[model samples]
Target: MDTILYPLEWFVAFVMVGFHKIFSTIGLNAESGWTWALSIVGLVVVLRILLIPLFVKQIKSSRRLQLIQPEMQKIQAKYKGKKILSPARSRPRK
Candidate 1:
């Protein structure tokens, strides 16, 4: 588990460190706890911006699927009384 999480941990730490550097360079109190907190908040905002497009596409796809679901149900209802034969049923016993 540690091995699997190592890369993920490193990635999160790297993002935090990068943000810390940005704050330090801009004359912020980088050594203060609030600076670290702001770095984390910044990461969240960046991630949300990146994911907004994906979230919108997922919502649109869901609506399209919903529109087709009734048609699919109608097709299923059309065939509700039909019977299907299996190979075992078509074979004779010894």
Candidate 2:
């Protein structure tokens, strides 16, 4: 995962540098390192905002699965030692 992420990190750094250069050209106080820092922070803020909905959906789905876990376990126990498609046989059919 680190191998896959390294390039992505580099790409983000490159974009931030490019953005800093553009801001400098526009005379937006980009001469200071703070401009690059703020750009990266802004990017993080935007990404977090975008992921909020996805995070909420994941939490809801996880809660629903938790609610169904007991019923799923009961089902497993009820079918224990029984052939799923052959109720009259003890061994599984070939």
**Highest lDDT, which number?**
1
Clashing pairs in 1: none
Q: 16, model 2: CA deviation in Å? A: 5.8
- Model 2 — TM-score against the truth? 0.56
Q: Candidate 2: where are CA atoms >4 Å away? A: 1-28, 81-94
Candidate 1 structure quality by residue, lDDT tens digits, 1-94? 9999999789778888899899988888977998899899988887788889999999999999999999999999998988967999978988
Superposed by TM-score, candidate 2 places the C-alpha of residue 38 at a distance from the truth, in angstroms, of 1.6
Q: Number of clashes in every candidate structure? A: 0, 0
Q: So what's the TM-score on candidate 1?
A: 0.68
Lowest summed-lDDT stretch of 10 residues in model 2?
83-92
Error of 1 at 24 (Å): 1.4
What's the lDDT of the predicted structure labeled candidate 1?
0.90
Compose the digit string of candidate 2's lDDT tens values, residues 3-85.
Answer: 98999788677767777777778787966877888777766876688889999999999999999999999999998998665
RMSD of 2: 5.9
